[model samples]
Target: MATFIKIVGSLIETLQKILIQGEIDEYENDKQMHCDARLVEMLDRLSKDVQASVKFSESFLIEKIQFLEEVKGIRLPLFIPHSVFLRLLKKKINSVSEFPIKFVNNVWGYLETVCAKVLIDQCGNYPKLLPSMKKATEHVMSKMKAKFAERVVEMIEMEKITDYTCDPDFISSYNKLMNYHAQFLNLLTSYMSNSITVEGYGSINIRHLSEVPENTRNQAFDLKMMMTTYWKIVLKRMVDFLALQLRFFIQKVVKK
Candidate 1:
């Protein structure tokens, strides 16, 4: 049993290395192996799908504003409520949670393919060992995908539950977005048009927001700008942090 386990471990290590480092000849150039390149292409497509799935709550901004108003008290919304901000963030995160799971599932599936190919190529002399190897690789693939799926769901929940980041870009982006706050309100009241044009944001429809109570408009805009700025940070972190984690994970698995 110990020998069988060691063989599976070695097999997993070999498959992981190939997926991470790609073809040995192209390793220095950082080019993906032919099969691994397909996985990368699929991941890129999944990323675009996730990006399209979640968007600024443009149409729903009024609903969120109304929700805040209903929960308001004597505070006059001097500041955006943390609970409200979290509510929006969670809603946004939940929308795209499945994409990550799908991505990890497909990634492990691709790795299984790489393993099978390697087994076929490397075990050509041991015809009887091929069946056992194929079985072991499939078992490892199943376990790997399940583990990743659970961790990814946990991660998505963490993002929804915790809103913390030290990136300075959030403040800079928020400041730029909020520069149009006064303009947003003015356009809401203006008889000239139903939309406001802000740099970087282009035309934003204020048709629904015009009716937002004066006392709460400031808070609503604050919520919007905060969500806008922080969402960018969240998306960027999801991409950057995942890349770092994946690299570390592959390296750790290979080293083992």
Candidate 2:
């Protein structure tokens, strides 16, 4: 009877051990799955953010390009040479002192109207009336590059706040993610240089019209107008290319 009781006690102890081991194994498996799910969620959010940013950038660039095109179509007389307008005005009017104050105002108004008409006529006939478009494209590209870089930095910073464990696999995955973002930024820079940059200028050059002499101001205005046209064309092309590339990138990230 005593031997039977000892055997039964040993059996009960073995079963209890087995049950506890099984519970522990199950808990560990659940924990691992939870961690993996969290990682997946983080990665998915990051990818979506990148895609959204790209879409926003594409839309913004397209809108800006359209605005520039519209500006190009507007007839602005500011590009006309002041000297030429002044000479024409002198021919149309008598001495300035011969008029009363009211007459002087009328005469100035007439001069402005004639100047605007002549400027429009000349611009319509002459291609050289506009300035260099390269300058405007450069300005847009610079802004794009800067904005893209800033966005990448922001993404990286956000990722650092995610709840990743200090395990080898997690660390490796985080490192790879950061490296990929860095590569993307470098790719953007490369695209800007290869696709957007025009020869003869490296940076945007802006001159204040108020600070320039009247004769040179007209030339400056012409240059500004030319830049607007150039920006429109280049921005359109860049937005198209970037949109396609960003879609491709998002697909690749999702697959990974």
Candidate 3:
């Protein structure tokens, strides 16, 4: 019986190590902030086997999820319900350590991809407005890159807290990374503005084209009026409508 108990304990320990290393490897590969808290929780939980330590670690993870719930104003999915996760961990259930790690990692990956796409799409449309989009792009990209760099540093420190060997070179690279990212942002913004100005100026050289052709003038004016009405009624209203929808979704999913 003692040997059997030891064998079970050994299995659990091995599982914990696998989860920790997998998490660290994923974070290193992705450098996203969303996974940072989850990794810390796993690391802390594995570093100690005491019941209280597990509880504390689990609670920390839950608190982060709660914060995400609040920030995005969206509830977590039902497959990984918050209450269920807490109850499972509190009861010392360990079957799904790998599951939680994988689920959260995938969720974060999706978020990162989508957010980046939104930024890029916005950037793509910047050429239409020239300097405004250029400045906004520069501002947003710098803020984003700095935020990412800060997150990477924080994750590296968190790894060290869990007794992982952090690469000093990685931390040192942050400064160079910041400069390069800023330069890239600036270059892209300038290039976009120049391209748009050239294209727009070229289009303007044809007097008939610069002014709407006589035949289509009325149609063009009508189209503009339609757009104005749409913007006033629909497009403008969607901004807060979406926010409220998001908040409602969050309340429904997380309130219980």
On TM-score, the leading prediction is: 1
Error of 2 at 153 (Å): 11
The 10 consecutive residues of candidate 3 with the worst lDDT sum are 195-204
Note the residue pairs that clash in candidate 3. Answer: none
TM-scores of all predicted structures: 0.81, 0.20, 0.21
| Model 1 misplacement above 4 A | 1-17, 24-36, 53-60, 69-75, 251-256
lDDT, candidate 3, 151-233, per-residue tens: 43343233222322244543343333233333323433445321111111121111222233332332222222222222223
Per-residue accuracy of model 2 over 1-256 as CA lDDT, tens digit each:
5543443344234323322222223234434223224334444543343233222221212333333344443345444433433332232222221222232233224323332332333344343432322233234434444444444344334323332223344444334333433333343444432122212322222221223344343333333333333323322333343334333432332222
Alpha carbon deviation, residue 241, candidate 2 (Å): 2.7
Clashes per candidate, residues 3 or more apart or on different chains: 0, 1, 0
Residue lDDT tens for model 1, 180-250: 87787777777567787767656767787676688677777788778877877777666554555455545
Clashing pairs in 1: none
TM-score, candidate 3, is: 0.21
Q: Write the candidate numbers in order of decreasing TM-score.
A: 1, 3, 2
Residue 108 alpha-carbon offset, candidate 2, angstroms: 58
